[model samples]
Target: MRGPAAPPPQPGWALKAATAVVYAAILAWSVFSRGPEGLQAVAMLALGYAVILGLIVFAALAFFSLWRRFRTPRNRARVMLGLGVFLLAAVVPPFAEHNDDNRQRDIANAEIRKAIDTLRQQAAGGSGAPEDVPAIDPAPRASGPYGEMERVMKTVAGARLAQHRAYLQELQEIGLPRLFDARRLARDTGLIESRLILEQAERLVPGYRRQSLDVLNGMPALVRSLTIADAEKDKILAALQTSNAASNAKLTRLWDLESQILREFGQMITLLDDNRQYWYADKNELMFGRDGDLRRFRQHQESVSRMVGEQEQLGVQSLAAVPQAPLR
Candidate 1:
């Protein structure tokens, strides 16, 4: 009995420190793997709630058990310290991720401002579209959360610029009425085809489902992108106006006319579609004859055409008055 065997030496301080490090690392990994966003997305789900509640209960029970086992005040304090560490580790990941997203957003905002500034400079220089619309190229390779944001901002700007240029050209050349007429005709043709298909049901084509309006499958949808808010549009317009008030005025008029034209067109189309029951389709041919609704359709078409003509003429005159308009 060598000195009554000094009670087994307590685990070395180094061992205790290592154990703490390992525990903290595991907790961190568990919390981070799901990510803050993922956790929030699932938090309301039944399974998610159960798991979260279970974790809370387990943590509480474990804390109390450890508290009792470590009876001495110093030991009790150490246990409390461990509990604090566990809570800190659990909370750090969510806060860290939230901060990172905010940082990324700030960086994206800076890049957006820089891009918009480039556009302003291009407008001032009159180096429009086909050459440099946005005048700011997206990063050659963009990845990660903020990278995606920058990419989308650049893409929307480019698309909006191209659309603006196209509208400008239409005003100068073919005119809005002609452009609108072509679209209306295309849509009407689709409606006629759909009518014929419905009249014939599955008899017109083999294996065709009566429920499927197959002929209208590729019709253009009437949706506007909402990525750019009104405020952003105002900012862009202000920037352009600063460069060339006359040119920007013309552009603005055309954009306004486009909205009005589309609205009228949609309403007319909806009216025609809703009263399709009054239209008769020739069973053997792709022909549709408007019956009782013929007068209504013609009247509406004439109204739209007249409105569009008036708007187009005004937009065109404005464009003509502006010498060296960036539109060309």
Candidate 2:
């Protein structure tokens, strides 16, 4: 029977206090549920607090203009919408399991560590921790570089090459070691054989090279990256694949070479890091052209890149006529 008095305006601090109480209630429940794991409970509470706080700030700004008392009626609608979104957000992240990012990053790091160990096993004679992947190495041969080179040449020159992109599938299944018979050879064996194999590989593979110290240093990183790449991983595997069984073993040797190169390069970088001032001096000297502990790393990279490109071109030209599947 009486006209309604104007509704009281809600104070900003009151809304914030209510939000804080809701959060505190949620945190208490979490702590009670995880009593023995108090540290974990605390961590969860902190996370929840951050997410909720972010939501509160976001909602406050979003709704301020929408509230009629705060601003205009139109602004009030916008603010209401923002508050709804913020409330929804506050409830979502806590239920998100909190371990998704840590899980994924842990998996990536695990894969990298496994790959490194795999390299060590293969290099040390194919043995190590319970690995899902087997490490295989090339055996050293009595044949000299020239003879090895001839073998590589024959492997490439045989002319009965299969050209198919699906070959990459075969590669992933077999791995780089399967591309060549590694047990029959070692570093010396490949120097000559590598010449031919590399010549062919330079063209046949998409991401590979035998020259350039910088690239040699980066090879393991590339391999590790490939093992973890979300897409185009096949390209990396393909580089390690070969149609010839003997070649597959040899390819494994190539993996060893790459591993050794990376290890050495990392060591070199460490050496540089230890002598930071010396490194800076030498780095600048090389770039500007005066020989003081100079390292021709960049120039070497460009020159080797050009040569590798040419060699790869020659390989593709040589094998272009061969019947094989197209690259994916």
lDDT of each candidate versus the true structure: 0.46, 0.38
Summarize candidate 2's per-residue lDDT along 278-311 as a digit string, tens digits: 4333321322233532454444445544544443
Writing each residue's lDDT as its tens digit, candidate 1 over 1-328 gives 3566544335557656754675445445445444446655544443554475457645655666665545544454455455546655776568667656665666666776665555444344333234334334656233355555466555544444454454344433433333224343445554564333223322322222111122112111100132334564454345434545454454455445545555555555566568655544354222335544666666766876676666555444432221121110
TM-score of each: 0.31, 0.27
Worst 10 residues of 1 by lDDT: 215-224
What's model 2's TM-score? 0.27
The RMSD (Cα, Å) of candidate 1 is 20.8
Output the number of the lDDT-best candidate: 1
Question: Alpha carbon lDDT of residue 285, candidate 1?
Answer: 25
lDDT of 1: 0.46
